[model samples]
Target: MNVGEWAAVIGAAGSLLGGGGFFVARATVKAARATAAAQQAAALATAAPAQQAANLAVLEATVRRVDEENGALRGEQARFRSLLRAFAWTVDRWAGQMHRAGIEPEPVHPLVEEYNRTGV
Candidate 1:
């Protein structure tokens, strides 16, 4: 072949190689970006359910603790009420003894009558 024609053939081959390399590099970059995005999406999807379950567990624990506290408070209230009733009965008995001994009895309050009728 003539030198000019050989030079043209080599130049065309180099151009084709350069264009193919550029196309391959662009395809590789796009594929890598897509893979990274897909991985991020999968990780987020997996983490979301775990986070929700943890939140639910915490809420359940809080509810259980509140219920236990309420039960304890109720027990304390019952004990306090029993002590108050016992004191009221002792006061009434002492007053009765004082009346029998000829001392003037104190007037009964309405609240004391209600307390005598109901243990509360």
Candidate 2:
């Protein structure tokens, strides 16, 4: 072929190849970006349940602590009640002795009356 013809043919081929390569490079970039976005979404999805489980563990620990505090409060209340009852019994005995020695007895306690009647 003539020099001019050969040059024209080679130039046309290079232009076509360059244009096709540009399109291929753009498609490759888009695919890589899409893959990266999908990976990020999957990572977030996997972490969500773990976060919820961690929150549940914290809540359960709080509930357990509260339950322990409530049990301690109940035991303290029982001990205080027992001490009060012992004091009441001592007073009742003293009042009875005073009556036997010539003083009138005090009226019975309503709580004691109720307890005697109901067995509580």
Please give each candidate's TM-score.
0.55, 0.53
Clashes of 2: 0
Tens-place lDDT digits, model 1, residues 84-104: 988898998999999899997
Q: Residue 15 lDDT in model 2? A: 65
Q: Give stretches of model 1 more than 4 Å off.
A: 1-45
Q: Please give, for residues 6-76, the per-residue lDDT of candidate 2 as tens digits.
A: 44565566568876555555555666677779999999999999999999999999999999999999999
Error of 1 at 40 (Å): 9.4
Clashing pairs in 1: none
TM match of model 1 to true structure: 0.55
Candidates' C-alpha lDDT: 0.80, 0.77
lDDT of 1: 0.80
What C-alpha lDDT, on a 0 to 100 scale, does residue 65 get in candidate 1? 100
